[model samples]
Target: MLVELLLAAIVLVLLALVLWLLTTTRRELGELRQATAPADAVTELLRRQIEAVRAEGRDGQEAVRREVSDLALRMRGDIGGLQQSVASELKGVSTEVTHQLHEGMKLIQNAQTTMGDRLDRAAQVVAEVQGSLGKLGEATLRVVEVGKDIQGLEQILKSPKVRGGLGETLLAELLSQMLPQEHYTLQHPFKSGERVDAALRIGDRLVAVDAKFPLENFRRMLDEGEEDKRRPVRRQFVRDVRTRIDEIAKKYILPDEGTFDFALMYVPAENVYYEIIIKDETDLADDPIATYALSKRVVPVSPNSFYAYLQVIILGLRGLKIEANAQNILNDLARLAGDLDKVREPLRTLGRHIGNAQSQFTEAERALDRFGAKLETIERKGGAQAELPEVGS
Candidate 1:
């Protein structure tokens, strides 16, 4: 387009030069024609020169106009092409922006929905916690009443709810659901014999888990405010826990019964377990009273550690699945063998009885053979006797 404009400008300048020359040439020719006498030859030559200049100027002007028109047409085409290219580029950019806006709006909406769901969950959790708090108040009242009732019974020499009796049983039942039924065997004295709270059977060894932690003493620790007044009671409670672990090890874990390869003092209460683990004393070995062993090692496990133990049990159960499968195959083989023996015994006995009966029948078969020979002899005699009877007739 720029080239076309430049060419048009050049053509217009040439045409202006041609028009000026043509006018000057015509004026010169008129002057030359009017002049006469001996200067006529000079006037005639000037007239011919003016005529040639006029003809050449007219041809140049025509050519210049044609070139200007072509250049103008080419410039118009170039401008139209540039306008189309600009329009298409703008349209593409606008379309891309619109697409991005839609995507951004979708992401915003998704984020809003996710935030709303999380808020709803938080509200639900708050409601549930409020309900739980109310229930906990009622449970506290029941426990107080139960403790008073048991104490009243104990005064009368009946011993209502002892620590190792009903409490351990209830706690064991709660523990059983989280654990394998076979791996954890309930050992409350309902079956007689020196039983444990629960026995976790691991291979040939047993982890005798006794649920015996003085919750009452721990509760006193929680209840006590003054450190000076609380210290003596707190010290006694520590001693009580140490004693409890030792007593459980001696009572529940009988090495004679293969009870304690290592025993577990299963505290279902996390706080109680943490208290013992965190609670230090003069007799404590590693961390606190929990890790401190009595006979061999009584590993104290709270709810969390017990869960870890349960996970171990789950993996153990998976391994035991293979043992169970092998056991089932062995049981099936034994049953098959027993059934085959049952069938085979009857068949063997029947064969023996048949042999005995055959012995009894051998004499009878021989006697019958002798009787048949005597009968043949009688037949021959009868023929001989028939001729004598004919003579007598």
Candidate 2:
């Protein structure tokens, strides 16, 4: 646009210069005619100069036109190349954007797959936890039921008869576990018309056990708070235990019925056993319950101590049986030794008779061989072969 405007201004300036030159030449021609000397030559020279200026202006206008056209063509080519380069760059940018979008989609899909697997595993873990919680709930219910049963048993144990029964049951259970059936008897009756709780048979001897425990006063003594009150209850408790021991001694220790000189008094409750033993240890020897019981041949035993005693008795019985078997074995061996001595001479005589019979048989065989050789020689001399003595003869 600027080049076109510049060419138009140059053409306008050239036209204005030609018009000014024509005006100046016409005035000079008029002046020369007025003067009338060389007016025609000057006018001809002015005409030639005006024609040269017009041609030069024409050439300049053509050159300016050519320059304007070339500039327009170059600007168009530059604008086209710039448009193509921009289009190619835009295409590359679009391809890269498409590739990036595809990669982003793939990443999102992979993330979704990983999240799904993790959620499935978490659900499995939750199910397992729920199952374990169910099992734990059942175990808690069982524990509550067991607690109720224990409370009920405790209430039952407070009765005197129930306590006595429990003691006897415990004693019986210990006997069953520690002794063979033949070695023990339950509720064994003595000649004194008293039925003992249990008895152990050691060889031909019997050892009675009494399971009845006098626990009423002992319980009262334990429950009382005042020292003065507890002292009387304790003394009464000790007296009751002493009386029970005397009764057991009088009834169960029957030497005439094959019982041992002493009897056993089993106290099933460990606390009661310890109380009596502790009293005996701390009290005066003359008034000691243990000493008094021992004097009457009534021995006090706790569950653990009685078990130990039973083990010793079982061992003693096994030793006695082993001793008897060993004695019988020795007797049998002695009898076998005597019988072998009696048969020794007969075996020697039988061996000598067999040796003599073998020697006689050997001599008869040698005689038979010589007779055979003599018969063959006679047959060769042409003589009638004499009848050889029969081998049997």
* Regions more than 4 Å wrong, model 2: 1-151, 279-286, 354-393
Best by lDDT: 2
Per-residue lDDT for 203-282 in model 1, tens only? 66567777756766666777789977677776777878778777776676666666655677777577776666765543
Instruction: State the lDDT of candidate 2 residue by residue for 90-166, as single tens digits.
Output: 99999999999999999999999989888999998899999899999999999999999988987888898998999
Residue 229 miss distance in model 2 (angstroms):
2.5
Model 1: lDDT to the true structure: 0.73
Q: By TM-score, who's the top model here?
A: 2
Q: After superposition, how far is residue 209 of candidate 2 from its true place, in Å?
A: 1.1
The 10-residue segment of model 2 with minimum total lDDT is 278-287
